[model samples]
Target: MPQANVDFSLKETAPNIGGGRVSGSEKLTSSFDLVEQMHFFYVRVVRVRDLPRTRNPFVEVNIGNYKGTTKYFKMDHDPEWNQVFAFAKERIQAVTVEVTVRSKETINDEVVGKLAFDIADVPTRVPPDSPLAPQWYSLEDESGRKGGRGELMLAMWMGTQADEVFPDAWHSDAATVSGESIANTRSKVYISPRLWYLRVNIIQAQDLVPISRNRNPQVYVQAMLGNMVLRSRFSPDKNINPTWNEDLMFLVAEPFDDPLILSVVDKLGNNKEHSLGMCTIHLSKVEKRLLPIPVCANWYNLEKVAQDNQNNMEVKFASRLHLRVCLDGGYHVLDESIYYSSDFRATSKLLWPPTIGVLELGILNATGLLPMKSKDGRGTTDAYCVAKYGPKWVRTRTIVDSFAPKWNEQYTWEVYDPYTVITIGVFDNCHLQEGSDAGGSKDPRIGKVRIRLSTLNADRIYTHSYPLIVLQPNGVKKMGEIQLAVRFTCSSTWNLFQSYTHPLFPQMHYLLPLSVYQVESLRHQATQTLSLRLSRAEPPLRREVVEYMLDVGSNIWSLRRGRANLERLLATCNLLVEAWKWFDHICKWKNPISTMVVHFVYMIFVLFPNLILPLVFLMCIVYGASQYRKRPRHPAHMDTKLSLIDSAHSDELDEEFDTFPTSKNGEVLKKRYDRLRSIAGRMMTIIGDLATQAERLNSMLSWRDPRATPMFLAFCILASIGFYFIPWRLFALGVGFFAMRHPKFRISIPSLPQNFFRRLPARTESMI
Candidate 1:
């Protein structure tokens, strides 16, 4: 099979090409040190030359330890094998691209020749636009002897850092901003460094240097840490003692290399700004004090930018800024609350008392979704859900050709602050075809809901459907509703701490410490098992039972369980349940509106077939243009106060409809409880009836029944072929004509096959 090759080139000014070989002891020592500063090396194998003629020749190429083979070519001397491999910089330091030629034989493959080249000689860095071109290299034999008469064309280059490669829009603070420019971000390929949040409160400035003798200084503070910069609001008309009590936060990488620079600048009348004095706070000092908690607020004197001995004496006593700063060690850059400006700390203290708990969130399913119009005029949606809690984010699989998608996925996240909110967003997956206009492309957001952990009662399971609300340019719209089950299990503070600090536990302190590949692998395995267990069980497992199994199976209870425990967990799940759910969902009829709209379109097509295509094409063009014009040109950050107020309003609505009795009248409360119980019993009866019908249908369609299996297969084949050739309008018309009529007419029309084939001999009788 042909493999995709990534091309890279080496610079002429490569480093240390002729360095002496290190001893095994030295190599081992340096290897550990080099691991910390590891970078990605992309090695591309382009082609091979001067190979000996063979019946079927193929070349196996190895970079570092990973190996790949080329397609075997019949009687070919020179074979092309374009393949790329990525390795860590530490491993590539003494890496060799080893190529071995082999001939395919009837009994066993025979080795024709072998050669290797050291890739350590390649340069580390190059300009982004100008990459090194592919070049031919002489291959060497096993003993470092130059006897092989073969050459390999190879190219290699260093991969750029994520921050440098991704566009600014990706890192922007706006959620609604179009991510078309983020196409090449490749965030999955790189792991972000551990990050910390630095909160700075600009309390006030006491006695600052005046810009002029008569004019009052409009002083504002600017805090800088590397590339991140934040500015405080200006203190107008407060020259002598400016007071602007504003808070600002900066997301910084761990091992904090740079000092936080705070500069007081005066706004001039010409719209220009002039710096008065500046102070530097080394993050190293902050790190030392953040062991237990951040350091207390203190007044620090600011140093003069340009010292004049005579003027400095006059300003020395007054040049100081009263600031309160602290390092928030637990924050992850990606998990910084979208509504961080909101006062969550104050709200937490007001709403719920302090408690320690783990929040178990089950994203069960979503229903009543609004179908998006596809290119072919079919109402369809590819829906997926993204749930984020603190630093962790979990994305469920995309359910294609579905309106009511049942994910039945569960995730758990540690909750340090009960006040913090978890945001779950459902979106329509839009694939952009090649050569399409980027600005015109749109990925429709179905809806999003945020839930605060503090609002829920501890140890109580709350499973309910929350309406998926969306805000469009016109107004707020009800997209659908998502069914979620959330339970917070309270644990003692000491126990929680012990679990976190356990020696055998994998590092859960950092947000998602596992690599992307590892996380993906675990999720895939778990999903497969869960799906399997749901299917084969005689009685379907309860949602609570499934969740409990998942919690145990996922190794979230304790990381020390390792691989054996995970495999055991996987074995307990049934796959058939998942398959059945999907099949049933797809086969069911859509909503009333969807059915009406589809039939209406079909009627138009049947009446005027030629005009239907032209009308659809024109509508698409108009819609795309309108969407392009409506796209936000600038990023807009969430309004914290508005978000909080909206959440409070939602809470009020929930309380109004809550089933629990809030009144003291025993008779009234008893009546309410009786009514609710009756409704629940009726719902259970309906569900049981539906299940019975489903089982009857399943048995009739089962392949285990010899009489039914052949008939079902024959019907399926005939239906598939008929649907392929028939126009959708004609199908819709035929179905509508029969559906609108009485059952007496429908039953009399389908007895032809049974009557005509009654005399046919059975397969068993023919064998006899």
Candidate 2:
């Protein structure tokens, strides 16, 4: 019966991955048992589509390995609604096809259909040997001839099978042509479907055991040569090293024993002109051995033992001695020991003081204020005057002298006087008048008129000038103008004052007329007008003034003192600078490379002066204290030798008087001495002086006290011993020490306890 054709759909479904539904027209079994042979076959999705709308679904298909595991498919077909069914059969064997139908209407939902096929291994047969097949002979020497050779060749007809098998044969004219025999032969050739034109020298006398005797040697050789061709997959290029050669095979070698030498090339594709000498390996020994050796063994001395074990061997053979290869510029050897040993330390002596020291300095600026000035200048005052005057006129004839005399005796006119007074606090126009005189005459006028009465120097009040004019105009018509002169003088002491108020101060405007006013009647006549003008005196001005002078001596002294202080501060900073440098230099040696003895000697010699400075200061302190204790009560110059003699006699007499019986005068002195001795004896006083001197000496030598010496020496000695014992470990410790040199970790020693029993016994007494 004809079979029913079952349809299959290929599907894929996974999170974030595109899913597809591909339907095949029918389920088809593979023509070969591809699973047994582990060969794959291919298939394609025939059509992929879904729903009523126009949008089409994505389709995917893959060929399966003969083991049923699939390899991803190449995209070969994409159409709006359908995919073509076209893929090779060998790549798609034993297919499991799943179909997925997806749409926006069911975005979260999925439907799947699956189909699988069992593939069978294809049947194959070996061809029968032909009577007409050609024979082959492996090459060998004949009759022991030096240049003897042989050759072999074979040919076969082709087949139309999917995989065709090649022929195998074993024929040799070398040695005995037996399995046990070995020979060196030439002129050999091998040909196969997978390999061609291969050659090998059969030179070793020993026969090579076949890896599998059951397997055909020619087939094995063909597969082996075919793999060689397959693995040589890269393209040949002039730029690549180990330049590809179809006829050549290169051997790999050990990096340490047979290191590949390299040549540098320039941009022009040529070898560099100058020879860069090759390095011959000369490895120093592994430093680990130095760890186990007693630290007492001088590192400088035992280095030869280390060198012997370095595992360095001179290279003897290399397949390709030198090859030109290009390397990226960024390539660098990262081994620190190799780089540091070669580029740095091995080439130079060990530099001492591995650590660095830092110093801090502070700068300050200072200045002063402005200077003061001195005193010198001043001035004096002004003057004033006042006047009053009147004008008149008359006519008389000499013929009527008697009648005129009688008229003169009877004629009297009241005279009104106008005087100008220069007053303070009044405007100039206030004391002014302009009109005719009392006689009503207009012929003569006076611009300025003053009457000189008596000089009132003491009162400072002169009379006003009331001028009297004689009217004698007769003989010559007597019509000439008459003139009058007026004068006055004043003394300031008794000057009359008027209390005139300023216009702005109306409350104080009342006038106080002078009591000493003396009037003088001086005359001028026929005045056109009596005009008076007033003027006020200006007030005195007030001022403040001064002068200055420099005291050069005081300035010089101040300047000198300031300069001296500045120089002293500068000197102090300079001392600190030098000390800082020296101390910093020493502290840097915390990681010194030299031995402890070297450091000890350095500390003793280089630091001795500084250490001794403290000692000298201490000695000076002791000396000062002792001198203070021995301070003289009076001037040291007084009494001189006499005082010393007197002191000696006093001490002796005081001592002797204590023990001996005395006469009346001596007894009285002894009784008084006993009372004085109770206060303080001469012997006790001497002993106290001696004790103080001893104390001073003892205190000054306190640095050498037994306990202090051990502790101080131990610190220095241990630091020194660190240099000898643990070089690397000590280096690490020194790193910490250097870090500690910062303020946060400065080496500050705690205060030491003082010895209350201040003196050391003599060596003899201690021994006894």
Candidate 3:
């Protein structure tokens, strides 16, 4: 994947810290900031005019630092893209739209023409209901002059214009009372923003300054980013080096320019806490490395705060904290990979809907759920379903105290890519009262299923039962099965490519880019709509065929987690064993005659070590030529059929064995027993014959082959006899030379073993 170059100059400035002094309660509340607002905009690449002759021409558009490309249109001077790109407000403030036309070639793509435009130049004063008309702009070359490559057409807009109210209505304090105004306010609008996930892992803290000399200190970590605050569990009975491998996730709306504040504090009496030391981590410095998922794990020096009034300031206690931080781009967009393009024009001909489609999923019910254990020794469970697609999440109402729960709810989602998966999980809901400790009793996860849209046939509704599979610490088990109905409906064929402008499909019509959070909100609304629809139904859906598919005493989850490393070691060991097995099979003595001949040759070599080379040369001329001349014969009558008379009797014997334990008279039983004894004797004879034939065949095949095995054996025998006469250094040098040249004589070895071992550690992870 190509990295997008983003310009950060246009990013919105950080809000200023409040100047007024705050009370104690206000300070506590202000320490944790909630994400309140998001920004969105749209960019449409209309078309590109006349361009120089080039092969496979396409346009690459760069906004801020992110880049996207259009499909290459072969030998077309005027290519129509008509592709719309959306961005979060934070991603495009100071960024310029860099449009470059390039021709794809065998070696590298060549630039045909290039143009740039600052986002500020685009007109944003157009009415909310109307989009700015596409306008042509002159293309420029390296010198910033007209390149004569022709012009490009583009249209840009912000999400604010899509609002129903005009600019004057924004300043009004009173709520609109008209029926139409009331309906509009009740409707939902989805605005997508670029999202980043920041993960902070607190591993351990070293020597620290204790508040009390007599008492052992208990330590915990607090991390602050913007207004969000995350706290780690207190370390078990404070030692000098305390480890808390806890992960904290924070959502970032813009580039991380601020430093993450880490304060290590000591627990005091009456729920009081005192800061021991603190450290500041600047994420901007980490971002410059440009890693896909950057991780920094090291011990950072902790600095004392000026507020500390300890008189022993000269002690200079060495303090540090081990931390690991990573910034991840969540839910990669389909636009990042060309293979899964969501553009209507690119996929229309090959897809069923020939454009974007809608997915309807119905969560019907679950059956034969394993009863969750309760404190009162009662087997019961309150279960609910949570389904996620892209950023959208939907949760069904809890079914109280039922092993077989029925939801009968239906929901719809926008299907952008058919290949993407939708995850649905069932959990045991354990609600706690306010002021109750969360650690008292935790909710248990039931099982989950992931369904891919592409696997379902379009326009066809399927109501099928799927097994709920879960991986527990002990093993994997089937808690129960969920019955679901699903269907995919494509937009009308006539209006598939036309812009949607209906109020019913607000999300599709407005064409505003969405973030993960907005998508989840939309899914929640769909779930509520389904709930409402269910209430109106005459007789709601019910569960059927209560069957439990449970496989106890099997822990496939643990096996899967550690299988990668075990598989690599097993594979390498298998290869080594196979090598020795082949050697043993090829070098075995077949008969007394052959064995005696081999022993005679060895005895001659042992008697005259100086003449070992001469004997080997002579033997090769005689035996090697004879072996080469004896070409192995292929099987004759390979397709011959057995005579009916010869096999007819065996059919009767097969039937007799198939019904061996039949209830028969005494005379019949005696006859059956006698027949079985005779057959067993014959079977043993056949087995002996088979083994003998296999050994003879293997020896014959080895003798007829003109390869390294026979020569290697002869050389080993000669070297063994010669070793006693030759010096140790000379023998070692000869062996090293022979081994070094073995690759030239043998077939090429594969690197599968090397690659497997290299990637094994990454596959096996230790739980933190």
Candidate 4:
């Protein structure tokens, strides 16, 4: 095997190559430390020459990555080693070589280096042949029965030299040989129904020398598994192939994006089949197999075979065994054996006034062999026969093979109420009659209905079949619920939804009731309410029937359109859609021009009167201001202290001013009003900054509440009223203007009389 040739075993003791006295051990160790710190290292080989004359001569080199994997470099055993040395030097950097061989031991005058590769350097694609390569066989694939369409794949490595081919199974360290080898490399021919696939690894190299007595040179090669594979059917606990004595060895390849496909075909028809939703040809060894789908059965019929004697005697008899097998694969002359058994008897007036006839059958076996069941061999076989014989003795016969007379047996049977049987029929809903609307709208009930069964004799009891009644509202609807009534025969002990079918269902001697009842409603409301009722044959009123009436609740009924629980679901959906469309129209519509004009006129009428007076006064002032004469400027008082005292005692002072206490004898009160005004102005500036900072933070957390819009309008009205009271204060108006984009502070008197303070400046500076 190529794996053995490329021995991946780690060898740490490497010889130094310099053709001189070994020295500088400390320096070498220091260099290794530096390389380790760098987290990278490289190996350079000088050459490999002078090998035996084998089919392929290869030298294995090791540079650890995953554990220590070795790669083979093949070269010829040529005397002239110059070309080989050149090849090896080109591939590797000599300065940073981690492993080197300086001088070789002389064997009969031929100097072979400690490491075979360093003996000589050569550059060539084809390496010398090695003895191991010729003895190994290439794993290949061949087709079995079908037109030789087969493929084969093997995981191995690349070698430098020809004879350096990887080892075969015998030379491999991980070849398990207890089980049979795959017949062909192609999966189709190597079908192993008893085993499941593990993994497949395509590596660069695989080689191993026998290292222990217990471990063979060739060990088993099982597939590699990641987490997903380990969780599958072949877990470690059930890994049959990998025993403790065997270990799968390989050059574990790098993971790939795509998955591998394994296919196999079983030649022997001995495999058991299971119709678990599909006709699966079970294989224990192979993981999976894609089926070659055959043409489906279209025109088919149940057929009972009649046997003719090998001799000249003529006989007329129906075979005991009857099968409903499809003839899609074409008619087959079955040479295999057939098994069957039946019991027949007559009953008296036990079936009531009708005096019904009953024929019971006790089939022991119908197929050629026993049913392939579970590992424990529980009740895997189905009860294939039943009937109501009306309390009478019935004769029965058993047969191993219908074709062979020696395989027959006989037995006696009696009628019973609770027995089991298997029956099959094709479902045809087209011919069924619509059930009568017997159940009222409020009661949980089923309409009078009967399932039409064909080919069943009147005397035979139809037990297992269940009758189902379904009612759907008529026409296009958005919301509605469906009422279903499923009644089963009293003999049926369980419903079909459950896993186990009650054995008594098939033993009923007469027609049985339906097995299930259901009321399926939509979750959404309807878009339209239609009064047009369903036909008389249809059950429009049946809405309460359910599989289990007590289990359903009104909470599940929905107002949402198109929901399952909504009564008249389709209608409800349509109605909701209409409402949404009406709202959408209101949103998209533009008001008429006449209406808009009326609104505008009304608004002007309501507001124009209040605005007229202010507008008229403003206009008069603007017009009259051009004709007014300018007032003469007043001079400042130089003797302000004497002037103030005399002015304070002036007779112009009102008696109301006398009420204020004087600062001294008959003196005017010394008030700090001017200082207070100055301080108040400074405080206004600080307040403005604080307001600005608060406003900034408020803006940061500004969230609009739709419900607060009305309150905000009311606040604006209050602010407007407050501002109206301060006629001459512009700052007051600014404070009231809460919706202003940016605020500025200025003091101005809009209504102040000019003569009131003629000496004072008209507008004060801003506090900012």
Query: Which has the greatest TM-score?
Result: 1
What is the Å distance of residue 515 in model 1 from its true position? 40
Give the residue spans of candidate 1 off by over 4 A.
1-259, 266-273, 277-284, 287-325, 328-357, 415-423, 431-442, 449-478, 481-768
- For residues 101-124, what per-residue lDDT tens digits would candidate 4 score against the true structure? 222223322211222122123222
Q: Compute the lDDT for candidate 2.
A: 0.21
TM-score of every model? 0.33, 0.11, 0.28, 0.12
Q: Can you write out model 1's per-residue Cα lDDT over 1-768, one digit (the tens) per residue?
A: 001231111111111111223221122112111111225565566777875555677666566455555567777678786654444444443457666767785456776666665676656653345545689876555455554547778776665221132221121111111224223211221112344556688888887877786888888999987755779988864667888877776655545677999999998878898888888898767632223243567787887755586766444434888887876543222222122211112111222223456776656678888887574678877666766554344555455567887555556765654434566667765532343334444456776655544334455445556666553333335677776656566576454322222221111213224343334333333333333444233222222222321222221111112222232223222336675665455446446665566678789878866545455544444543444444321111122222222223433333223443433358977677556644554453344334333433442333222223334445455564565567667877998997798866654222434321221111110000
Tell me the deviation in Å of residue 680 in model 4. Answer: 72
Worst 10 residues of 1 by lDDT: 759-768
- Residue 169 of model 4 has an lDDT of 13
Error of 3 at 237 (Å): 40
> What would the TM-score be for candidate 2 when compared with the true structure?
0.11
lDDT of 3: 0.49
RMSD to true structure for each model, in Å: 30.3, 66.3, 29.3, 46.4
lDDT of each: 0.49, 0.21, 0.49, 0.21
